[model samples]
Target: MIAYDLMKRLKELGYIKEERDPYWWPKSGSFEVVVGAVLTQNTKWENVEKALENLKNELGSIEPQKIVEMDQKRLAALIKPAGFYNTKAFRIQKLVHNMLDEYGSFEAFQKRPSRSWLLAQKGIGFETADSILNYACYKDFLVVDAYTARILNFLGYELQTYQEIQEFLSDSILENLDRIYELYGQEMPLSQIYARFHGKIVEFCKEHCKGRDQAEKIKELLV
Candidate 1:
């Protein structure tokens, strides 16, 4: 099936039916997403949550300026639950410093995002950068993670790289904008569509794409 068809199926299965906190990422446009994006690398969301809670408890907030002023060692200890604490702390600090220097604040950066600048950061790769853009900046960039690749591969697509997978799914949805509106009964923004689509994939995979019976489970759902 095509990406649109899969998205329709996932929606029908009751994913993203209502507004929720941490729907895909923490409330969109929050600075916590920026920090969570980095902390989430090579770790589970639960671990990321622990680290975020630690930060919120310690600093009472997770602002970029606060992170910039905080000591790296202390920051590392707070985020240690997410793993690679030392490296992630450094990267997070560097990102916040550069972002503040360039955009002055998280609100300003959200107003005018720069994908190239995000990618140029030390630990911000394509996925991490795209997460910040899509979730934090509310951009129309679809995030392709391992779940996306696995689901597509199970659907008989031979996409080999991140770009190919992202392009295929994005183009499919873009080309069928009218159908999407009909499906949802409203003209949703592309950013929201991409966000919900990624959320559906992650949720679906978590529920039905585990263990040796993964392929069978996916086939049953698609069928």
Candidate 2:
């Protein structure tokens, strides 16, 4: 199956560093993950991390209520490293307000983060929504970013839409859960598998297949 093959090839190549065990994304189910999901739009993860650290230093917390109560100017200044600071700060405030008004708290929001609800938010797109779902809420939605699309496209999987790629991955995963269990000697939930898959693709792209020459080198390594 494609899932098994992809996972095996990714493992044999060892693209991700050993430090990120189980997965390579940020710490799951935390406010930091949620903020990072939004902050990382159209920017590098390194920039988002700087913004996160800045926010932590400024407010001592990234919680929803704290974000809501903070002055918009201060919030924007703290997250300036993320780029599009004013817009991102406004979006985060709006997200926090929505959480408080609808779900009462981040804890409650994470309990059942509706995909439609997330998509309806001001700054949320498909990839961002799914990142919040999987990483922040620990939900089963798999994120398909540019890296996922590029690698698959390079490998001759030409999908037209995000839904197409998502469904393809879901189908592959459904057909290969048994193989995952067989290899790991334990049952891996759909969410965990999706998280790890997304993380691995991100790490692999970041480290190995960057530009065309880098991609060719990766192809050689794989062979």
Candidate 3:
């Protein structure tokens, strides 16, 4: 399907209003994107933003070494707003330190690897790993997000697990990587696209899909 057609359907379903969510911030680096993915689980982006800002102020930087070297307690404090601060801090520290110890530097870690290797990291689920690879490393990947899930589920598609969605989308775009890249490029990199896409879905769920009645109607459209 054409990208415009998909966009139109999403807009008509009240999933992608042009005016309500106009901002997009593309990701800059792999480590930074991974940090975000870890911090974002079950939390508001606004809170994540606050925590990230605090981390920057306290650590003097967001580079892997800094994150690895930060005091666990203090680091947890800085990222408290992101929730589950203790676990997140350890996760972030381990990820950063692992990258440094294994690869020696951020540039080394940027090297592309077999998909199996990516799947092996702790807290590195398909989405988080793909976000890091596609956004931070500029690899061609079709990111299946919460919005994608809601829209697909509404269409009577039941992705039993995240892997199922990943595999389906991966297969759908397998022969069309270039086209996928172009469509995704319109939202490019991953950060801005992710922020806008996530924000749009969250807003739509809050406004239109809050109850069973609305949700059922929305799901009917998918059929």
Candidate 4:
């Protein structure tokens, strides 16, 4: 029932449609997904795709061991299009090496129970960690990105802190990991839905909501 209503409103506002079902949804337990999450920070996915392609075509694989062992200068050159190449390359290589050193393999890293520890990694942030958790590890956790905050605040939901936003979105919806994961396959859970939802919101805001205060804009236009 709720999904129906949400979909209806989102569609009316041109946020989603049936054709979006097969739009490159991440498969669980892939090393590429985690690396993509990291590289995707503050950059467009197209650039990330290019970087991944370079790593794969020239380096043979996108595995952590391979990435960690690659020359930093060459890796940076390959991922330069993704922006912040120097720093990101170092971070990516270090992260991959750390995963190997600590967990033996990417699969082993995924199987570990130390989510908090993983989150505490050098290049990992809240959104990045949550992305890795949900997409790579297939764990249930709400990913609070800039779009989530903007859309929520525009919708008259005010969160004072980042943690508050996380709690609100995670609590208001899914109660368990299994249920959350289930939403992705069936109709898109708040976790998965929020990413694309937020993506669409950013698109909408850029096209229509510009120059207007978000709160007033959402109320006047979206509602």
Which one wins on lDDT?
Answer: 1
lDDT, candidate 4, 1-223, per-residue tens = 3223333355567764324332223444588887788888998777888988888898787877778778999999998878999989988888878888888888887876366877778878888887777667656665667766776677767787778987776554544435434534465544455455444554565556556565775667666
Question: Highest TM-score, which number?
Answer: 1
TM-score of 1: 0.94
What's the distance in Å from true for residue 130, model 2? 0.5
Q: For residues 77-137, what per-residue lDDT tens digits would candidate 1 score against the true structure?
A: 9999999999999999999999999999999999889999999999888899999999998
Give candidate 4 regions above 4 Å deviation.
1-8, 11-28, 175-214
Q: TM-score: which is higher, 1 or 3?
A: 1
| lDDT against true structure, model 1 | 0.89
Candidates in order have lDDT scores of 0.89, 0.82, 0.64, 0.68
lDDT accuracy of residue 94 in candidate 3: 84
Off by over 4 Å in 1: 17-19
lDDT of 2 by residue, 171-216 (tens): 8888888887776678987887888888778888887666574555
Q: Could you report the Cα RMSD, in angstroms, for every candidate shown?
A: 1.7, 1.7, 4.5, 4.2
